[model samples]
Target: MKPIVTLTINPTIDLATAVAEVTPEHKLRCDAERRDPGGGGLNVARVIRELGGESLALYPRGGSTGELLERLLEEKRLRRWPISISGHTRENFTVTERKSGREFRFVMPGPTLTEAEWKTVLDSLSTVAADVEFIVASGSLAPGVPVDFYARVAHIAREQNAKLVLDTSGEPLRAALEEGVFFAKPNRKEFRDMMGPQVDEPAGMAAAARSFLEKGRAEILVVSMGADGAMLTTREGQYRAVPPPVKTASSVGAGDSFVGGMTFGLARGLPPHEAFRWGIASGTAALMSQGTDLCSRQDVEHLLTQVQPTRLA
Candidate 1:
């Protein structure tokens, strides 16, 4: 089987803790904290590994946190292509209030990349893109990285004859779309923001997606709508996947898991709708776990059986 390669321009160490409550001006006690290797692409890579799939995580690392991130990845026995940088990698904090079940996240902007650093990353991607069948570029671009970074990666993927699956938002996504990509997975807010005020309803959303398809910007569009389910459109048809109802632990990383599952299905040669089922399953599974634990292989398989796909006109 061809290898799966994920490119994460910005990665971090995710620290999660449970607190009774978060009240301003009041000191709060918290439970033990858990730390894990994180970032959008890293989450996807971790999910892929949990599913017994092989993936190479390509990202930059620096400072002491970067060392911890490397150690964590080593503990997972996952392969990595580390691009050493001068700046330290950032850290993200997730605080879950056990009583209210509310989760608050504090994300830090990652290390800034220099012109030389960016060129090195691009060169490395040029090499790795050749050996992989799929290149999953998911996450925010750090400062100093051009907005068209993903677009360049998309171009490289095309040159290597590999599929590029993009999971990002805002200008980066819009910029990449201008350059054209194979697939894109954006949540409701990101989609709305990209579509602007013109798209306010479901039909409008569909139309905006169709516009992208018509322009050949993306072959498949997956818009995840949180608890309302997800909308998937392809050249062949469109469908909405409604997952079984369950209590959501933490919404963080769910979207990344969805991308991971969708990529997993595509890698296995599944049809679009079938692949979407896995994507929804993976997302719902991630919701069942607290903090940054993400989705497990067992949860994903079990939830896959409960995912129902409805065709859209």
Candidate 2:
């Protein structure tokens, strides 16, 4: 099988620790500190690897933190295309409480790239495109990068005849949509943010999605609604996939897992609805794990059996 290629313009070192509680004006001590390589596309790659799929992760790296991130990926034995930069990479912190089932996340801004660095990364992608089956561009754009970076990648994917799956938010997502994409995975709030005040109701959300479809901006639009499940809209039809209710352990990385699962299914030529089942199952399965561990093959397989897709009129 050809490898799935994931591009992450902004990547980070995810440091998670346990704390008794998050108290105001106090330093609380905890246990079980863990650090992992993260970022949207990287998380998707992690999920793919866990599911017995092969993927190549590409992203910019810089300084000592970047070195740490690379070492972590090396430990996982994941293939990578690292674009060297000058500034240090960023770290995101997640604090989890064992007794309370609460998690707090602190995200920081990643390194800013120079024009030369940006151009180098794009040039590297052109070379990578020739061998990749799918180009998955996910996550935020770092400073010094244009909002349309993903849009440019979409064009490159088209030129290479490779499918593109985009998972992002706000203006970058809007820009990608304007340039057209193969698929977009947006959570409920992100969809609302992109559509502005227009997506006030469920019907409005559907309408906004239909408008995007009508314009051919995206071949498929998946809106993830957490516990409410997900809504999938495509040119062929619309459908909803709901998973069997399970108590969520932590919501982190669920959406990325969903994108990974959906891309995996689509890469295998599965229909939209069937792909959606895999997506929802992967998402729910990720929610069943702690911290940023994401979904395991067994978790996804068990959840797949309990997922049901309903056609919408």
Candidate 3:
């Protein structure tokens, strides 16, 4: 088995285009379109492949859109295992306004999954995760899937002796934490919402995350603050990786890139603090690219020099 395996239950075909401007009630002509296979775990697997790491991406596929998604990932030469589903995979659209450089995104709730289909995903994980070091479950649950899906994944990872790295939000995240994961990355807002109103600042974030660690909810937690940077909290201590300022072309896929880089670094035997810096550099590098373009290996290497990680507590 590969060292890392990623799972995306709700995947999408991302269609992106650029327009001169966006105005209500006007027909806006768009530039040439670009399509990418997108979803949290898929993006993570893509970024890992871009960084010269190997990982297997596991996700559902159906209909013509799903077929195209598979083709797109194939073009990128990403290793994947597609679970067959009865529902057509969803398509998400993004239009970047060239004049204002603003992006407008239309995201569809993904296709519903049958009970048998989701159970199939779990069953597959039992086999695929048996020898993998890390099982990265990222993205949302599709309609008709339980909110405890990732929690179930965590249980499988535990039974298989694999570390579960989760990147998601809302009740699914909360439930998964109850089941416990090895690591979790939640954006600042999501972290705040999950931790409640009392965790209004970074100071409180460390304390709350440590509490989770002490309770065995997670071994490590990361709160990403976009341009501000990200904080890593573990039972041992807290560290923050801050990036040098750079102009951001697009924010799409940055978070997934971060998770990919960090997880890849860990798989490569980097210490937690150093892996946190890799995540910061990779995420910042992703911001330097235009729509749907993730960070390249060269860009990540260059930005690695610009990331400075400091012990917070």
Candidate 4:
């Protein structure tokens, strides 16, 4: 197996806690807090680390918040390469309502990236792509960055014969799909946004995903439906796995964890079906933790034993 590399263009430092209630124009006393290195790719890298896999995390950062983000990742001992930028890195906040079990997430738009700065990421990928097996680009694009950033990455991945796994949305996601990635993970909403409003139903989703595969947009596509579980589609077959209901602490990192599990499995040459189950397991495990705490290896292994995958094709 070759090395795994993850790129997060708009990563954040996540601060989370529980509050009795949230009301505007009132002082809301919060409970004990937790801080973690965050953003789509960072969370995926953390999940990969928890699963006993190693990955190189690449992102741009600056200012005090950026320093804090770097410190957080350092505490986790994740291998990282941070590109210095002009503006400060952003921080996101998650507040869980103790009474209703609802989580309120306030996401900040990350700093804008200039053409020169964004190009550094591409140059870095060019250097690492040759030795890597998978290049996973997850998370939202920063302001001022081209929506085609990931498409440029897709071309680089192809040049180096590396698989690209995407977990993003909106124009960026749509553009990358046009480039034909190795795999893609789109939640129910993102899938709907791409294929149309009718794609939310399971049958419609399967058809939409199959169409994507047939059109060469993606070799394998996974649609994550919260509560309804997840489904995987490929040229060879389609499979669905439902997670056993468990008390969810926070779903902050579940999607990233799922991506981590899928990459970990595929890198180890596991069968695609089995790898899909691993993704389901990792996602369920993530729900078992609180705040910024992601899935654990132990929980993922235990959850893996209970995954019942059904082939739909």
Give per-residue lDDT, candidate 4, residue 68.
94
Tell me the lDDT of model 2 at 310: 83
Better of 1 and 2 by TM-score: 1
Assess the local accuracy of residue 234 in candidate 3 as a C-alpha lDDT between 0 and 100. 81
List, residue by residue over 1-313, the lDDT tens digit for candidate 4.
5668999999998999899988899999999888889999998888888888888999999999999999999999999999999999999999999889999999999999999999998899888898888999999999989999999999999999999999999999999988889999999999899999668577888888898898999988999987788999988899998997788888888899999998899988988888998899999999999888989999999999999899998
TM-score of each: 0.97, 0.96, 0.98, 0.98
Candidate 2, lDDT over the whole model: 0.88
**Local accuracy of candidate 3 as per-residue lDDT tens digits, 1-313:** 2658999999999999999999889898989899999999999998998898898999998999999999999999988989999999999999999899899999999999999999999999999998899989999889999999999999999999999999999999999999999989999889888878666766777788787688888887888999889999887789988877888899998999999999988889887888888899899999999898888899899999988888978
The positional error of residue 189 in candidate 4, measured at the CA in angstroms, is: 1.1
lDDT string for model 2 (1-313, tens) is 6889999888999998888778888878878678899999999998888877889999999999999999999998899999999989999999997669789999988988998998888888888998877889999899999888888888888888888899999888988888888999999899888776676677777788898799988999999998888999998888887777887878899899999998888887799889899999998899888887888889899989998888775
Better of 2 and 4 by lDDT: 4
Q: RMSD of each candidate?
A: 1.2, 1.3, 1.1, 1.0
Worst 10 residues of 1 by lDDT: 194-203
For residues 1-313, write the lDDT of model 1, one tens digit per residue.
Answer: 5778998999999999989889898778888888899988888888888887888999998999999999998998878999999999999999998789888999999999998998899899999888889889999999999999998998898898889999998889988888888889988899888877655688888788888688898999998998888999999888888878878778888899999998988898899899999899999999999888889899999988999899886
